[model samples]
Each structure stands twice: as C-alpha cells, then as structure tokens.
Target chain A: MMLDNTWFVEKSYFEKFAMAWKVRKKLHSEQSKFQKIEVLQTESVGKLLLLDGKTMVSEIDEFVYHEVMAHIPYMVARKCEKVLIIGGGDGGVVREFVKHKDIKQIDLVEIDERVIEVSKEFFPECTQGLDDPRVNILAEDGIAFIKSKTNEYDVIIIDSTDPEDFASGLFTSEFYKNVSNALTEEGIMMNQTENPFLDEWGVGKIYKNMRAQFPHVQSFTAPMLIYPGVFWTFGFSSKKYQGTQLNPDKIRHMQSLERSLKWYNTEWHKGAFALSNFHKKKIGL
Target chain B: MMLDNTWFVEKSYFEKFAMAWKVRKKLHSEQSKFQKIEVLQTESVGKLLLLDGKTMVSEIDEFVYHEVMAHIPYMVARKCEKVLIIGGGDGGVVREFVKHKDIKQIDLVEIDERVIEVSKEFFPECTQGLDDPRVNILAEDGIAFIKSKTNEYDVIIIDSTDPEDFASGLFTSEFYKNVSNALTEEGIMMNQTENPFLDEWGVGKIYKNMRAQFPHVQSFTAPMLIYPGVFWTFGFSSKKYQGTQLNPDKIRHMQSLERSLKWYNTEWHKGAFALSNFHKKKIGL
Candidate 1:
C-alpha cells in the first residue's frame, strides 16, 4: 500500500502485470530459511503476506482461497478424517479444516517455521485453529514429508506458494504419485493451481500431472481477488467421486453452515465445478 | 506497462489497491470531452485502453467481458431482435451482439467519440461490428437518449464505467425508470456491475435500483481477467426471463455456438447466476 509514496507491489515480472496496495505500515519483514517473508498493513485490504515478493494471502480475501481449498474437497468427498496440508504455514487452511466436525486429524507440513510464527502474531484469526488438538504443524519440506506415507490421509491439500520458488517440486509427476500413494482408496487431493487467464505456472501442467496418478481429476475455479489471475483455479484429483455432482441431501446438509461463511456455499460449490470452455480445452476434457 | 522506467497503473484511490502493467510504449493519449483516453502497448497484454486512468479493456481478455455482456442475456431472453448499447465505445459488446443471427437493428450510443476513434485505429477487432449495416453508431449522452425512447428495444445493455464522475447519473434511480420504459414488455437489460469482491462501485445499489423497475432481477458473475475484481459481476434485470434457468432447447442451441466462442458455454452460463454468500448478503437476497 502507498502512503507518502511508500507502496508495496508484487509484479508478475515475466507476465508484466502487478498488484499493489497502499501501505499504511510495514508490520514485519525477515528472511525465512526457504524464502523472504514480509507482512504489510494496507490502507484497505487488511494485513497482507508476501513470500519471495509473491502474493501469498491477505487478511480480507484469504477466506476465498482457504475455504475453497479445504471446504470444497471436504464436502465433495464421501468421508474425510485424516487430512494432510502441505505448505499452508499461515494456518488459514488449518482454520477451515478445524470447522469440519468429521475431521479428527490435520497434519500441516510447512518448510518454513518462520511463516507460522509470523502468522500467529500478525494474522491471529487464521492461526486460531493451530491451537486446536486436531492440528499438528510440521516444519519440514513437504516434498520430503510425503515420501514415506502410504494410503494414509483421507484428504490431501497442497497450498504451496507459486511454483517458481521452493515449492516447484510440489507440482511434479513424482509428487502426485507420492500423494496418490499417500491417500486412502477413496481419498481426495486438491492443489492450489494458478489463475485461469494468466496462470504463468501452468494450471494445465498440474492437471496433467495429477491426472496421470488419479482416476478422477477435475479442475475447478473460483475468483481470488489478489491472485495474478483473480479467476483462480484448483486441481482436484480424487480416487472416487465426481466433483461436479452435488448430492441433494449433502447440499441441504451444507446449508446449515451458510451463516458461518463469507463465500463458499451450496450454490457456490455447484458453480465452482462448471469449468469454462477455456479450462476444458486446456485439460483436454 | 513498464518499459525501462515507465509503468502504467490504475489505483482504486479510495480502496487503496491498484493494477499495473509493464509498458512497452504509450501509443496515444488525449483528453476527450468525457474522460482522459489512452492506448498503451503493454509488454505482455496486447493493447490496453484506459479511461481517466481506469482500465477499460485489454486485447487478450476483452472477450470475457464482451461475450458475457452480450451472450448470456441474448441466450436467456425468449427472443432478442433489436438491441441498444450505452457507453460501449470500444465496440466489443456490439461485435458480440452482431454474432447473434436473430439480432437485427443494433444501436450503440457511446458518449465519447474519441474512444470509438482510438478503438478503431488501435483495437480494430473490437470495432469490426461498426462495419455491419445493422449496427448504428450514435455519439450522444445515453442517459438523455434513453429518455426519448419507450418500448422500443428488445435488449438494452449498459457498458458503463465505474459509477463515479459523469457516469454517476447512469447509476441513479431515474436512469432505471428511463431504461424500464425503453424496453419491450419482455425485454432484458444487463449492466456491467463491478467486481464481486472489491466492488468499490456498489453492485447491491444497482440491484436495488433495477429491482424497483424490473420484475426479474438477477446478479450474475464472470471473470474478466484484466478487470479489477476479476470476479466481475453483471446486473441482469428483465421483465420475465430468469437468468438461472437454462432451457434445454436453448442449452442445445448454445452448445452449437460454444466451438466459435472462447469462454461462454451452457455450463458456464448456468454457473454464472449462482450468487455467493457474500453477494447474497450484499444484495440482501
């Protein structure tokens, strides 16, 4: 955010587009083991987080990303109990997972512990779930953390930063194979793929890699106001269940929690799976 | 767009957020009677149009806005023959309307003549419809022009800028009554409402204004990649047609046109009308 000419801008350097907010003040700045991290207080958009100068999450619109990442797949799956979240150190996804009454365990494997410490201090709301007994935060490389698991998690979420950084290995064929091996037979996994229009990291590449390892692979989209392409997409790979099909009873049951949400709902869920022709073509669906 | 040290940015001044593009060069800049007009050659995004420093359209993603503005309403209406567009100086919406074989007379009333001239020279693809015999280009104050018509057009579209400056009158209650009188009994009018998330212009106010005049008022959303709040929303107000109901025959027919278009499809159309909980709360729906 720009205050007295002090502005924070995240440039999609190669793509030539950037998102900037007027800075009220700089909350924190430091170098993590894996990346550079900074939190700024914006004039309007609440607290903002940047890792390696890339937009990771902001307080105001973070719900859209975290809710779609955790709630959509959870509601679509037949059952979810043991869940693995890779690289969501900010605790936003962990917060959403804590809302699910059925989930008993949540393992968050983040490569950087500094991100978690900073998040707990600056964005307290997102970090509230970290205090819950269900959560287990692991400060380890996600690429290395998923190696030993076999048919373990009921749901797996990859909330990595842009693939150009340390998280590049998370969007590979071998990573998908390891994730596939780590899920139960009817498990579901979702990776935070990039925007549909200007996804420089390639949402199609994630779709292809996940499809090679999973029986049911669907790419759904949502509007993420701060992402490079506000028209953001997620790669959903499942062993069983169609992401498009919303069971009537399940939808009715989901409505009870509507009062608690800012964006996701039964209607939004249906719309999320209706892929645009642009997406269908990219995935060869 | 930044070339060397030159970067073009649009700041939502009150909102404290902005979009910037790395510039290859500034093609043209002039002050029109209405607003500051500019055509910038961006490094990545092809041609960029700016009105008073606000992004109006970009070459690469203009189709999403134009197609959604024209196609969704055309397909939803029981029948559309005569059409009217207000303030769409770029001619993108007119080009989409011209594609409908069912549409006959097309009247576009853009207040700024320079925008048309700049678009014709810099962005010809958006202005091709100006060559069609069915399309009429009328440079006038659309608010005043609509006041003279009554029950004349089958479809009316308001491709307006943000509801500030001179366009503030366009969002007033009086304009809604004038538009209601200008439409045939079953006519549909869609306006380019702001983004779903960072809707600094107030989509709910437009919904309330149109709901007072029209029987069926629906707010549908699409992702305009170049637009602020890329999760853009459109206010669809009609005397009868429900924008959400996809008539099977219309769906079958819309599928035929899918191959020719880039984004709009039967499924995407269905998804467009699903209001998010945030939108619902904002609109008091």
Candidate 2:
C-alpha cells in the first residue's frame, strides 16, 4: 500500500468514511497500466485486493460478491451456455461460472492482464477457471471489444472496477448500447454498481444509461464487508427478465448447487431485490 | 473519545476490523454511572451516539435501525398498544413507536440516564418521542426491571448495547424467560442483536437463549453504517406471528408512515428476512 504503516486505510466517496485493515503482510505491489494494484494479507479479511486504493475483493467477501454477481443473472436467464465477463481479471466471476458444468464457452475480457496474473499467483482459487478448455482470457480494453460484437453472449457479467478514469466508460450510455446489442434476445447483464449509500449519483447514472437501452433495469443489494457503505448493489439490465422469480425448476437448479455456494441461494435471490425506500429514493429507482 | 484525534475509531469483535469516523466536533463526552458516553458531530454520519466506545446511533443510519426495530414487530403483531422498550436511552425506538397512533403507551427503561440526557441535548430528533404523554422514561437497570413485571407489556423492545459487561445480561436465558413472562400471551419482542458477520458466537448464543424461551424465534437484518460489520441483524422472538407475512392492514400501517420512515417498508420488511447462505451458516441460524 502507499501508506507506510500497519494499516491499509480506504478513503473513498470524498473521504466521508474510512475503513482500515491491519496489514499482516504485503503480498504484491505494482503499477499496472490501469491503476495501482496491491495484494495484501490482512489480519481480518485475509487476502485483500486493492486497485488505486479502493478495495476490490478479499478472501472474506469474494464468495459473496462473486456468487451474487455470477449466479443471480445466470439463474434468471433461461439459457447460459455462453458467457462474457468484462473487467474481472481477478477471476472470481469465472470461478463461479465454472461451478456450473452446463456453461459451454466462457470469455473473460480484462483490460489489465496484470490483474489476472496477480490473481493466478496470489489468489489462485479465483483464477482456476481461466485454465478450463471452454474459457478464453482476452486481455484487452472491454469498452472497445464489446462494440465489435453482436447477439453473442447469453449472459454478460460486467465485473468492472469503480466508474473512474478508464473504467468509467463501462457505465456510459454508448457502452450500454453496445452491451445491449452484444447480448442475445434473452440475455441478462449484471454489473457491480457501487455502494448504495455512497455512490447514489454514480449508481443512478449507470441505471439511467442502462434503462435507455434495455427494457428491464432493476437493482439488487447485498451487504459486503470491504465496501464503503457495506450495503452494496448490483445493477441487472436485461432484454426479457424481471429476475428473482420463484420457479420450481430454478429452485432445483439452485438446490443442486447448494453445497458449493456460500452466499447465493434461491431464497436469497428473491430477497436481494428488496430495496428500502431510502435506497430507491437515493438512486432515483 | 479516549483517543485525542480527529477520528473516532471502533475496535470491536476482537478488533478483527476497524471502522473510523472523522470527528468534525466533539459534542459531548462523559463517564456515566454505567459506561462512557460520547456524542460527536461526524463528517459522514453527522451526529453519532457512542456508548462505551461502541457506535450506537448515527443520523444517517438511525432511521434504518430504529425503523426496522420498531415497525417489524409492530406490524406483525395482532396488538401493539402496550409496549415496553428496554435499554433504548437514545429514544430512537420510542420515536418510531410514537408514529403509530394505535400505540397507547410506551415505557422506556434505560440503564444509563446520561445517554438519554446527552441525546436529548445533542440528538433531539431521536429523543423527541420521549415527550409524548403516553411515553414514560425510567433510568433503571432493565435486567432487574423486567424481572418485576409479569404479563404486563404487549411488546418488549430490547435495544440493549452489546452483550458486554452490565449489558450482557440482556442476552441471557434467565433474562429472556423473564421477558417472555413479562409479555402478554400473544406478544412479540425485538432485540438489537449484534452484527451477524462478526459476532457469530455472540449472536448464536442470543438465538439459542431466545429459542429456548419463545416458540418462534426468527431474525431480520438491515445494513447499519456505524456497526462493525455494517450488515446488522435483529432478533424477533414472538409467541405468535411469523413476521413479514403479507397482511393488507399491516401493509397499510407501514404505508401510512412511509413519509416518516427512510428505511422500513412492507416489501423491504419481507426482504430483510432473506439471509444469504453464508449469513445463515455464520450465525448458525
């Protein structure tokens, strides 16, 4: 970390609040083309990944964020043979997708190859799916890559970083249009929006941009430990899905994966859509 | 705060993680008859109430916690006219209860009178309900107070602090039996159980204790900002009523106070019970 101390502190959302993890060991530190990447072994959250001082994933919350991101939209859709992941170099999303044997082709387009490399070394569990024969790891700019595709992916997971600088294009109107065109008619796209409490404006902008292109745009929330607000949200914009619908077939599908999942479940999938009045009021949902 | 610094830090749950709030100003600080009480004007959370170095209530999250605490049981129960609140010195619970005109009487028993007095001076919004003609404030020990009453209150709200030192008794089996006996035949009680993520042992103990006493012991969670894990939970133990059950009258009751509440709603109430698989496994629910 940039700080020369035992604590790795995060000051995001205009320094409104700060959360510190006691540094047990600094696993890796480097400057990637996108941002500063650092992997730290912490006292509490175990292995912590930081991109430009913002917490991206940890050993503690990785299962929760990744499971919710990958499984929620996958279960909602009727088909999931092909998948495209953008900006998830950490491979957590890929690992979740790998759990389901039905997925035939997997494409992970991460702008920073260094993130994937680091994850393979420091966070190998998340990167195990990268070696699967059905998977394709494309180290390229996600924004440019999506514009060249059409009606391809059954499920597209935009595991983008914070909507800042280079990654900011991920939440733009032009990008949403490309994503809409990139997906099949029954496609569902889930993006890690941001903290519901801190990033209301950013989240709202993403929602607005997605709403213009997609017919169904909804949000689901889950509490994440490393996140600034803890109450984190994921934006679901699809061509034909309200999501969280109770289907007996999907219940069996969820039940089959029960022993593997630590976070996502059929009951939770339905429950995650429950947003408080203030949550809606803040993000203009 | 004990620390002579700009940040008010909380190191709870064996300091597995730490949350720090920047102090704009120290509004009040003192050692009460029980524990240390401090009220601070914070940069992010605004006015915050801290009891014995633990974050209690903040302007940003008070509505979320207090609303969930008060309204969930109130709407679930067949009757909520007579209520007893144990250890809610800040009056946040009372404030929520006061919104329901159907509630005829409320008795608030707090161990520390200073928390109430300090909140009255610094956090007037939370304490405004204390002035209601039907509300009564008693600066006495709740553990002893509940033992004296039998079948008196229709609902009991245990807004006690962490199960530490003097407040620890609030989560004990004996105390729970006393509380169950103190309530009417068809009564409900809600306690501010600690963070489900951080306090698995502590939370499980309370659940086991409550389960032994009440036939129905369910839990509901909300994202509280100042708390350790931020993913906070409350224990719902009732003689009857599988809460969050859809009732038109209760929905109307929740909707009537929609303008007054920032967090609680009928939809969110049912959703709040949606615990992640990891969350259920962690707390052994």
Candidate 3:
C-alpha cells in the first residue's frame, strides 16, 4: 500500500489576473507493497498547475521548463526523428516532441511504470499523447537502456527530477557518457540542470562534466513559477550544432506553434539565451 | 492585542560564493494597517529590516531602489534641489536625496511614527543620515502633507505599497493632482510600482493615473532580487525630463558602485527599462 497523500495549493494574484499552483505528495509508504509516488497540487507566487495529489506536467505561468527542455534540442538537431526521453513519464516532453511532424519515433524510457500510470489517471491533459503509436514506452533503467543502444537516437532529453533518492545516479558523469554514446554524431541533448538561484554551483558542475564528453556546452536560465526559486537553468550539450543558431525554417515552425502557450514565445526564446553577464562570466560564455 | 502568528519564509541563494536572502512574511492581523498607511515591513521581500513588522528603510539593497528612483529624477530635472518624499518614513529616500550634495533640503512626510521609530532601531544604516540638518521628518498623512506645500519640491517619490489598504488613495487621480501642485514646472515624480509579473494591472492603473496629471509618463522595470519575483517595475512620470537620457556623471557613479553590489549593475540598469513587448504595448509606450 503506497501512501496516498497529495495536496494542492493555489495562489492567485489580482494584478496580473493570474494564478499559480504547486502539487506535492509523498512518494512512498513503509506499509505499501510497491514503491509509491504521491503527488500534490499547490500554487505559489509564480507557478500554475493542475492541482491533484498524484502528478503534474508543467506550471502554467512558466512553461519554459517543458518548452526549452523539449524544443531546444528538437530545433537544433538536423533531423530529430528518432528521439529518446528518459524519465519524462508525465508525457509533457512527448507532447512537445510530437509537434515536429518529422519526428517518427520517441522512446520514452521510464524506470517506474507507476509514475506513468499515475500521470495517466491524475493528469489526463498532460498524458494525452503518451499512448500515440509513435511513442515506445519502455519500463527500464534509463542508463542501462541507453548503454544497450548504438547510434540510435538523434536527440535525447533528460527530464528527471533533482539528484536525490532514485534520481541520484541520473546526474553522475557516467550517465552522461552513456547518453553521449547512444546519440548519433550530430545528436543534441538538453537536461534540466537545476534551479540556478538555488543551485548555481550544481549548474556549474554539470556544465563542467558535460563539457568533458561533448564538444559544445551551454546553459540557459528560465523562470519557473512552479519551482521554489527565481529561475531554473537547463544545460545543452551537443557534438556539432551551436545551440544559439537554429535553422530559419525550424525557428519559423516553432513560432508557428498554434498551441495556446502561457509562456515561451519568440522573444522569450531569444531572451532565454541572453544570459546575465554574471552568469556568462561564471560559465566562461 | 495584536496577533503574533505571522509566517516568515526566507529563500537564500549563493552568488559569488556569498549568500543572498529573499524573505517573505505573512501577517494575519496587520492587513488593515498596510491598507491604511501603505507600509508593510514584515511582508516586504527587500533586505530592509522590519521593526515589530512595521517600519522599513534601505538595506544594502536600498542603493538599488534609491539610486534608480532618485538619480533618474535628478538627471531629468537638471537642477533638482528641493524634494518631497511621501511615506518614506524610514529615511532611505532622504539618504539617497542627500547624495546629490547640491540638494538644499528634503521634506519627508510619513504617516506613522511607529515606523520611523522602528526603522531608527533596526535599519540604522539607512536612517543614519536621516538626522541631517537639510532633512525634515514630518509625521502626518502624506496626501494632506502634500496639499499644504506649494510648488516647492523639485522631485517627489511615492514609495508606497499596493493599492489595497492605506495606500489605496495613493493611486487615485486626486493624489496625482496634488503631486502636480507640489512639484516645480520641470519637476519629476517616481513611484515604486508593484511587481510587473504579479501585478500588471496595479502598475497599469498607477501609470494611467499618473499620465492623467503629467505630460510625459514612462514606466521602467527594475530587477529587485529580494522582491517576490526577480523583477519589479517602477513608474516615472514627469513634465519635462526624458526618462532615457541619464547624466554622464550619474552613469559613472552607478558604474563605480556596481562592484559593491550583488544585484544591480550597469547591464541591469539598461535591462531595467527593457520591458516585455506586451507590457510596452499595454502601457502604450
């Protein structure tokens, strides 16, 4: 029996006419038979979400987390048809990937089947496209799953959580090396580094480690309303493409995204890359 | 008896290997007090100290808020010596005003004696220069205080809170008329508007109200790290000064002070005015 406790918090502001939500829940109970993942929905000064205590995809006020995590690499790679997503069982990344009509396949490697199952039940909006024919859901360790592949994925997105508990090994340098081996020569990978305001050093360390294996490395900070702090930083490492320059057609395609997005627009796309001088000095950008 | 059960939350981040704190406190009992008088020290996110949760003055972060609020007006007015501060009971505004050295005198009208006394205790760094001979601390209603003065003040800074309680009248058309009456022909007035991300309409209303009274109205966004969000916006309304052109000496002064700050710098100063296109369009700038 997994502990089933999730709470939702909503914070509404009158000025901007916007509301932010955060969902929090316990992941396990000693009395449960299988590992339990509890999700809660809550709102803060700056994030929005579907408030149910089981799973969440992205905060409404700040969608850069999902947008940049999925689109940066998708737009950078020459032809990102066969992509692999590790730990994004929430289906938000897959939903973003499927936007590219060119993407023929997406291998969603999730370790715990329970998270996907819970997301499907609790967050239908976020998991709507996970069962699409093009997506291949594999219940396995992402690291081992990557090691077994050869020149398989053209783009890889790591949508894991903080480097704590089961997600600990995911942040190791070894895991990045495995990911590098699994990608094609021109493949690009973008990972949710961590909160820059809270984890600047963590971001710095990841950038240093990613640079060891990849020829090009860059990090950009995006404001996340769901997260606790100012903005979250995502690390982009690639073998060929410079993350800043995107194909004009692809940029046009991204801009033409008809989806009603609350955040992440063209100006935001350019601004995301325009890092603060302090951040630039720290990363030697 | 006052309710003492207030929740204080602090978010700290490490930058340049030093810790910076952003704090938020919720008061269950003092909601009305903030509405009536326009100052809520405990709930403010900046670095200033709150004496018994009421009075506020400049912290180290005070320079960021004061310089932009003061220097902009001074540069615009060309020879601004006489100034009036509404609700700056903590004397932070007066301290920034005195930096001009040429300024003859400043009349600070604060409504609450408690706030000044408390600020004198907790925020000694900011209030230290408050007792200067050129400054006069008048404890009275800011609106009534302004009505009594003629075209005396060259600049006026309305550093009040949201238009929820005591500060509600500060956002009215009547207040703007009185502000106009109090300023010299080329005088300028700046108000510390609310968070642009959280309270756009609140700021929009102030800009609209100020525009009704002044010939030139411009709103600029400044990054105050300690605020609820990373950025806060300030509205500058004037009869003569162009908001963009700054005195070369003041720019140099700001540049020299960049090394002493953890947040505000020259890049930030320029970026402060770079509003989102949406905001620029909304404000009709």
Candidate 4:
C-alpha cells in the first residue's frame, strides 16, 4: 500500500503498472514476524488489506479473487469432502468454501496472524465464514504444513500472494510435489498464478513445474480489478479430474445455489478454461 | 496524464482508481477543440496515447482492445462488404477491419483530426490500414454523420471515448435509434461500453436503450489493462443473427491466415459472450 494516508497505490516495480485507491484512512497496522499487515478504509472499495505494502484484498471486488480461486477447483473435483486452503488469512477463500454443502471439512493455513485480525476487524463479509464449525484455521507455514500430509485433502486451493519475496518458496517445484503428495489420488490443486501479461515467464515456469508433478495441468483466468493488470490467472493441476470436464449433475446443483456466487457460473467455468491463442502457446496447451 | 516527467498516471476521478506507466520520455502533445492529445514512449507498453488525460491505446496491449472490439462484430456478421467506424481516430478499428478479405469499403468518421495524425506518427501498427484504397477517412461529428445515413453499412462500430463530456450524446436513446437506422436490415453494431464497475448505471442505461432499438442485444467483456477496471465491456446489437452462434468454417479460414493476433481466438470469441451472473443481472441479459 502507498505510504500516503489519503491514497494507496500498489505499484509493481517489475511490471511497471500501478493501481491506486482513494482511502479514507488507515484502519489498522501491525508488523508480524512474517510480513507487515495493514487495513485501510477506502471511499469506493471499502476496507483494503495490505501485506508488506501490497494490496491483498478489499471489501469490494474480493468476490472475484475468492470465487475464482475456490470455486474452480472445488466445482471440478468430484469428492470435495476435505479441502485445504493455504495463505488465505483474509478468510475470503474460506468464505467461498463454506458455500459448498457437500464439503465436510476445511483447513485454512495462513502464515501471517495479523491479516486474520485485520480481516475480522474490517472485512466481515469475507471473514465471517472462518467461524463455521467445519473450518480449522491453522497459523503455520503452508509449505511445511503440506509436507507433513499424504492422501489428506481432496482439494487444495493456494490463495497466496504473488510468488515473490516471502512467498517465493510456494511456487518452487518441491512445494508442488509436496502438494501433489498431500492430496488424495483424485484430488485437485490450484495456485493463484500471477497475471500473464505481467509475469508470463513466471506463470509459464510455474505451470511447467506443476505439469512435471501432476498428470493434468491447466491455467484459467479471472477478472481481478485491483491486480496490476486487472486480469489474474490460476494454475490448476489434478491427478485424476481434468479441469475441462464438468459434470452436468454437479452443475445443476451449483445452478440451484447460484445466489452464493457473484462472478463464477457453470458457463463461465467452461469459458474460463478457453484461453486465447497467445496464452495457449505460452502455457503449451 | 500525470504531470511527472518519467511516469504517466491515468486516474479516473469518478471511478476512484488510477493506472500508472513508467515512461521513457514524452514524444508529442497537442490540444484540439475536442480534447488534449499526448504521446509517450513507455518502458514496456511502447508508444502510449492519451486523450483528455485518458489512456486511448498502447502498442503492447492494444491488441486485446482492438481485437475484441473489431473481431467480435466482424466475425459474427455474415456480410462484411462495407463498414462504418465512429471516433476511432487511432485507426485500430480500421486496422482490424482490413484483415477480412470480404470487407471492401470502410468509412472512418473521427471528430478530432489531431488523433489521426498522432496515430500515423506514433502508432503506425494501428494506422497502417488507413491508407487502404477502400477506406474513407471523414473528419466530422460521428453523431451527425450517422444521423444522415440509412441502410448504408453491414457493420457499424462505435469506437468513441467514454460516454461523458462531449461524447455523452452518443449513449442516448435517440443516438441508438439513429445507429439502428444507419445499419443494413441484417447489420450489426458494437459499441465500446465502459467498465461495469466504473459505469454500472451508464452501461445499464445504454444496454436498455439499445435493447429498445434492436431485436437482439448482448454484452461481452474483455481485459483492458489500462482502463479503470481491468474488465471492460462491449455492447452488441444485431438485427438478425444471435450473437452466440459461431461459424466453424469461417473460424478455420481465419486461423489459416496465421496473423500474430495477441489476444483473440475462435474459442475466446465464444467465451467473451459468457457473462457472469452479476453482469448478466446488471444488463438484464
């Protein structure tokens, strides 16, 4: 977030694109052991959460990020009884996970504790689901947490920040292999891939690494209004379920619960997988 | 544009968002009766054009905007002999129109002559098609020009600026009626509607007005990196054909041409029309 109190600008040095929001004031600020977390109330976007000077989530448009990350993998996987979400301290991912009726358990592992406190204080719409009885919020390093488990989660959603600085290890090949080992044989895993325009090479490299470990790997995009380019991508890797194949029965059920979603739908789910020629060549689809 | 020499920031005061680019240097600046025009050579975006302090286009991601705006209507419309483009002074619309072998004539009506000159100097990639023998460049008000014509063109694309200030009249019900009359019985029209997040009521009003004039109306979205929100929408109004149908044979032929289009394809063409529930409800789709 920008240091200035009235305005918050998230400038991407490498990408050379900046996004700024008009803020009312800083609501909270705390420097945790892992990262610095701050919440700002904005004029239009509502409360904004910043980690290490990077805008993580806002009360407005958080649904785009949370819905895309959680719904894509959760909807595709057949048996989504057990789910693991890593690095979603704001609880937006958990908010989406609770929408699924069949999901019996959810574990959210966030390294930074301050983000949770900020979310609870500011972004209640996103953090409200953390109070669900089925959810288990664990404050731990996701890499180490995933490494200890095998055949555990039916679906894993990494709602982490960009793969740089404190979160660089999450995109490494070793972490992907560990994630693969932790998931059930038919489990699906999705990581929040960076913008293709800004980090084409990085996304390609991460997709390559995930492909090396998983049988089926693909990338999908969603509108992230606050991100550098506004369009953010996600990498999907599955051991059994192909991301493109959608079950009609599951879609019918999801259609009945359409009120829970804002951005994603069954048609959009199929359309999101349809990458452009440029993106298709980049990820070698 | 931001006054800073090394960086140019496009901030939308109404939307409460800003996009900044690191620039090498300023190339040119001119003030016309319509608006202020400036050209800047950027580090990554190549040549950037700003009209009235609003980003018009950049060399790097112009394809995403131009391709989606031009190809969506061009590919869907069966006959493409004659076309009318209103207010695309940069020539990006004409550039994409000439790609079709069937398109014999294109009439480009741009109010500001300075924008055309700037495009010729800095954005030749978008202006090369302006010199085609079949293309006619008219320096006049698009509203008055369209008002005089009837059953004139197979496709009419409104590539104007946002519906504000001088261009506000273009989004009215009477203007849409004029556009409907200017088109052939089976003609199609596509307007560069603004981002929904920024102009939800404006887009909804335009969509409602267009629906009253045309039999079939639809809205599609595309990522415009420099816009207020990354997701920009386009309004499609056709007299005959449904917007969702795609011709497989034409797609095959277009693919055989092998042009290096950065951000459009047959699959994406279809995918672009798949609206999210939020947008669908907003536009009354």
Which candidate number maximizes lDDT? 2
Which wins on lDDT, candidate 2 or candidate 4?
A: 2
Residue A176 displacement in candidate 2 (angstroms): 0.9
lDDT of 4 by residue, A57-157 (tens): 87768998888888888778878899999999989889888988888999999988778887887888889999999999898999899999999999998
Q: Is the docking of candidate 3 incorrect, acceptable, medium or high quality?
A: incorrect
Looking at candidate 3, what is the lDDT of residue B98?
78
| Model 3 lDDT tens row, A64-137 | 46666777777678888899999887777787777778899999998877777767765566677797889999
By summed lDDT, which 10 consecutive residues of candidate 2 chain B come out lowest?
B1-10
List the DockQ of the predictions in order: 0.57, 0.55, 0.12, 0.55
Model 4 preserves the real interface contacts to a fraction of 0.64
CA lDDT of A145 in candidate 1? 88
Candidate 3 stretches with Cα past 4 Å from truth are A1-35, A40-64, A72-83, A102-104, A147-155, A177-188, A196-220, A236-247, A274-285, B1-85, B88-109, B113-117, B125-141, B144-157, B173-256, B269-285
**Evaluation by DockQ, superior candidate among 1 and 3:** 1
Q: Taking the candidates one at a time, how many backbone clashes does each contain?
A: 10, 0, 24, 1
Displacement of residue B247 (Cα, Å) in model 2 is 4.7
- The TM-score values for the models, in the order shown, are 0.96, 0.96, 0.68, 0.96
Greater-lDDT candidate between 1 and 3: 1
Give Cα-based local distance difference scores for all models: 0.83, 0.84, 0.63, 0.83
Q: Which ten residues in a row have the lowest lDDT in candidate 1 chain B?
A: B1-10
Please state the error at residue B161 of candidate 2 in Å: 1.2
Compared with the true structure, the alpha-carbon lDDT of candidate 2 equals 0.84
lDDT of 2 by residue, A96-129 (tens): 9987888899999999999999999988878888
Q: Tens-digit lDDT track for model 4 on B1-285?
A: 122445687767464666788888889998988899999888767788999888889887788878877787777887778999999999998988888888899999999988999899999989999999989999999999998899988999999888788788888889999999999998999998788776544678889989999999988887777767878888889999877775454787678653577777877888777778878877766
